[model samples]
Target: MPLVTTTEMFKKAYDGGYAVGAFNVNNMEIVQGITEAAGELNAPVILQVSKGARAYANHTYLVKMVEAAVIENPNIPIALHLDHGDSFEVCKSCIDGGFTSVMIDASSKPFEENIALTKKVVEYAHDHGVVVEAELGTLAGVEDEVVVEAGQESYTHPEEVEEFVSRTGCDSLAIAIGTSHGAYKFTPAQCTRNEDGVLVPPPLRFDVLEECIKRLPGFPIVLHGSSSVPQEFVKLVNTYGGAMPDAIGIPEEQLREAAKLAVCKINIDSDIRLAITASIRKHFAEHPDHFDPRQYLKPARQAVKDMVAHKIVNVLGCDGKA
Candidate 1:
């Protein structure tokens, strides 16, 4: 099937109490892994391209790769999206370049400026038959080009959501409740220790989310930086000559609960990166003579596939809902 906008998908997710996974794609293997798993499970998927991804793998290449996935898996729906678009030009380029959806993340700007910029993008995107997502709050952590310090992050004010949506006319809204941008989402000080000596991050502000839902009433909501940062992958990476400490993420149960509410799209990028890095690290440790990229990338791709499948069946709960 051809690419589809998130309009119908979000409507279904809102009614069905599940969210679609928006996995960021950087390369051929990553695209193949995510789409393959989604295809097998008969789930609709969103392949998102970040500005860094467009810079690393040219925009044409990412679009073509997603188109190829569309051809290879005709049974399930696929949407190409631009993640965290910071400017009108960025969102317009994606909309004109065949992306089914785009996000305008002007949350860091003044409230009025954000609404104006998002409304501009929304006008352009809607004219081109595409849907737009806008963000209202700043999320903490570093993810690609987006970085905000811990104290600097602010949760989405539930009071402002209705006004933002009414003025911007964005198809969906991405809000910050507690989830942040990267793998190291919380510092050691912000988290407490669990029985296994693992750091448990602070719980999400579901009260805030519930208030937003009550106000928006049937409108689609989105969660950015939703990766669970699987502990297994962290241990694997550390064991194989990598050093990353206190890399925590939002708990999966919290995300699951959010999905059952108004959240229709959950952005997960760090988990894919972690899965790939962990596999490549382990492969290099086991095979010292491996030089060809494919030698390691093949396994790395499978790691991505496995991780995405787990998310589909377990975390997002969108399997068989295509």
Candidate 2:
């Protein structure tokens, strides 16, 4: 099938009690790895690109790579999305450029301003047959160009959701409920150490999520910064000439629970980076004489495929859901 909007996907997920994985794509390997797994598993997937990604790989290159995936995997549904678009121009650019969906992240702005900005993008996107996703509350942590301090992070006010969605006409709502961006979601100070010496981050404010669900009944909810940084990958990276300390992410069980709720889209990007980094690190360590990019990237791509497949079957529960 051709690239599709998240409308039908979200409707199905909301009723089926599952969320579709929206994996961020940067280069050819990452795009191939994600879509290859989705194709094998017969799952519908979203290939999202950030502004940073567009700058790094060039917009045409990224879109063509996604187009190649679509052609190769004709059986599974794929949606091209713009992740965390901060302005109306970027959302409009993606809509015109070929994305099936775009997110207008005006959450950092004042409430009225956010609604106004989101509504502006929604108008353009809907007219062009593209779907819009908008964020309500601010999320803490850094991802690409988005950086918010912990003190500044605010959970989505359930009371405002109805008004925001009604006025903005957003197709999906991304709410902040303790999940943050990047590899280090929580600092050690905010978490307690478990018996295994791992830092246990504070639990998600499910109460807030539940309240939002109650207010926006049947509307698709979204979760950003939802990657569960697997400890195994972290250790692998650190063991082989890397020095990332105390990196943590949301737990898998928690994300699984969220998927079974009203959440229809879960954004995961850091995990793919970690997986690729770990595999390349291991490959370099084992083959000091091999300098070709493909020598290492081949294994790195395989690692990504494995990780995505695991998520499809276990966390997102969208396997065979195409």
Report the C-alpha lDDT of model 1 over 1-322, residue by residue, as the tens digit: 8999999999999999999999999999999999999999999999999999999999999999999999999999899999999999999999999999999999999999999999999999999999999999999999889999999999999999999999999999999999999999999999999899989999999999999999999999999989999989999999999998778899999999999999999999999999999999999999999999999999999999999999998889999999
Candidate lDDT scores, in order, read 0.95, 0.95
RMSD of 2: 0.6
Tens-digit lDDT track of model 2 for 1-322: 8899999999999999889999999999999999999999999999999999999999999999999999999998899999999888888889999999999999999999999999999999999999999999999999999999877899999999999999999999999999999999999999999898989999999999999999999999999999999999999999999998999999988999999999999999999999999999999999999999999999999999999999999999999899
On the 0 to 100 scale, the lDDT of residue 177 in model 1 is 97
TM-score of each: 0.99, 0.99
Model 1, poorest ten-residue lDDT window?
Answer: 242-251
- Look at candidate 2 and tell me the lDDT of residue 62: 97
